[model samples]
Target: MDIPAPAPNGVQLHAPGVAALREAAVGLETAFLAEMLKSAGLGQHRESLGGGPGEGQFHSFLVRAQAEQIARSGGIGLAEILFQSLMEARK
Candidate 1:
């Protein structure tokens, strides 16, 4: 499942696919965190606060960004474990 990209300037690597794998793992973590945040009602719009249709529509974007940040910050350590597992499996 790992595909190696071409190297340039005589530079080569025996494990060039780790980056893609790591990215995929992180992305999965981010999505999971986003859904978790959504379920936790972190982005819920309050009518008393004058939140309306627009806020409801864009609140998800805010939640997604916050989730991405959390994931990037070692969120629940899922991403790291997933990356390691994927790397080992590929090997």
Candidate 2:
């Protein structure tokens, strides 16, 4: 069954069962990993050979995409734990 959830634009959208929970869990894990990567200087520019303003401007997007890919590829197991927690909370 679909459950009504609020979207960012204030629209009511239907969240479809476990799939939605899994997606959300993965997203959360991605965000967490992205932040961790950022803290670890994954996308930081180097003083000597930096890509300049453009690279600085879009480094976050690259980091986030990388993090998403990692999450989708089984990640550090955070997504699975989060998915299980979400499933338990929904009950």
Candidate 3:
């Protein structure tokens, strides 16, 4: 779970753990969207989760769901790992 240094493109690489978090986010988002579509009885999919491009209260819900996935994958130490890095950077 080593966080990579910020890159030239202003993209800071995540820790290996963060990558896992991102994957969890994607998976959870997918599952959640499926459930929503099913529950709503759209039967296939919505034109979009919100209205148009970038509208997703539903998406935010998925992000929160992913947090649980991360906890499951990384355990409580994921918080420690992130907090430790934050503390170090503050110094």
lDDT for 75 in candidate 1 is 80
TM-score of model 2 vs. true structure: 0.77
Model 1 per-residue lDDT at 40: 94
lDDT per residue (tens digit) for residues 14-40 in model 3: 535545544444454445544654565
* Candidate of highest lDDT: 2
TM-score ranking, high to low: 1, 2, 3
* Alpha-carbon TM-score of each model against the true structure: 0.80, 0.77, 0.32
Q: How many Å off is the CA of 27 in candidate 1?
A: 0.6
| lDDT tens digits, residue span 1-91, model 1 | 2322343334333568867776787788989999999999998998988866788899889989998888777788787778767766776
Residue 84 C-alpha lDDT in model 2 = 68
lDDT tens digits by residue: candidate 2, 14-91: 445767887888899999999999999998887677577777888899999999999888888888788767766776
lDDT of 2 at 77: 85
Runs of candidate 2 exceeding 4 Å displacement: 1-15
Order of models, best lDDT first: 2, 1, 3
Better of 1 and 2 by lDDT: 2
Clashing residue pairs in candidate 1 are none
Off by over 4 Å in 3: 1-12, 44-91
Rate residue 12 of model 1 by lDDT: 34
